[model samples]
Target: MTESTGGIDMDEDSSGTVKKFAFINRKAPYGTVYALESLEVVLISAAFDQDVSLMFIDDGVYQIKKGQGTKGIGMKNFSPTYRALEGYDIEKLYVEKESLEERGLTEADLLVDVEVLSRADMAALMEEQDVILSF
Candidate 1:
């Protein structure tokens, strides 16, 4: 028995079941809506008590890069939101190591703490998600 409420699926039979949701972010943060949209979705899933994790790969790694200057772009910098995820119990954030290396960035360059995973490990993590939402 599945029901839909406010855009969220509710399974009567598994009322308390927690679904593992993975938000895969692959775009650069400033120029597109993908990063912001993904962040909002992650917060929404977390509010539902779902197990939510975020993986930033490719240019998405720039989403959390430290000292983002959006002033020139006339966009509000949303990088700080990543730090607040811990308060919502959405702490499982991962970044692709290869992506970071290719971009000449290191863990210290990110605004938030995250587990850096190899491409192989990232694939394994994705396989464990009950729902994978790519942005």
Candidate 2:
């Protein structure tokens, strides 16, 4: 392992290289498995103790929207799972400001606190990551 930013360990894999992770969510909640699967992966990744960032754009912001109810659709609402992420040390959540405004949503509509970013800022943040996974 080599020295990392902020003095964290830069772990080497079988190939002897470290990678940063960025997860992008662009799908709405409950309609498909994307949202749920992303959450699962984020939790798992957090266990690795690596640098991880989650970005929500487009309809993806709905994954963390408050007041989610699926009783009428016969599905279990998993949005509450976002609340526990902080316990796992996964606090880097970025939501696109434009996306929220387009959907008529404000920061208060979200279930958890997130750093809202402009499109350009989000793009720059994504560019800083070594591995980007979109769901």
Candidate 3:
């Protein structure tokens, strides 16, 4: 009495697994569309259960600054939206140490807590990611 397996082995032809992604934001949130667009992508990735991370560099760090007041310009400050990321399980937020120092901002000034990494560390970390999206 021999038992036979009915399922075909599909793993042989699989192209590995879906890649972990790292999003590098290099622009400010307001006065441009990059920041908002990046945020949308992050949400979409989370929805798909993708392993995703966000890194703020250059002027992009300003996007998460606390106490942003855009009402005077008829625009609502969207900084608070970052706080919602945790609920989506997208908590790997990174801020470049040099960028923050250059802008004279401490982590306390940011709207959310983030892992601060030096440029060299960031570069190494980025290399480990399977995909990198920059905005």
Best by lDDT: 1
- Order candidates by lDDT, high to low: 1, 2, 3
Overall lDDT per candidate, in order of appearance:
0.88, 0.87, 0.84
Poorest 10 consecutive residues by lDDT, candidate 2? 1-10
Which stretches in model 2 have alpha-carbon errors above 4 Å? 1-18
Pairs of colliding residues, candidate 1: none
The list of candidate 3 runs beyond 4 A from truth reads 1-18
**Candidate 2, residues 43-75: lDDT per residue as tens digits?**
998867777899999999989999988999999
Clashes per candidate, residues 3 or more apart or on different chains: 0, 0, 0
Ten-residue stretch with the least lDDT total in model 3: 1-10
Per-residue lDDT tens digits of candidate 1, residues 11-42?
A: 58767888888889999997899999989878
Query: For model 3, how does the per-residue alpha-carbon lDDT over 1-59 read when each residue is reduced to its tens digit?
Result: 01111232337573445557788899987779999988988888787666788999999
How does each model score on TM-score? 0.90, 0.86, 0.86
Give the candidate order by descending TM-score.
1, 2, 3
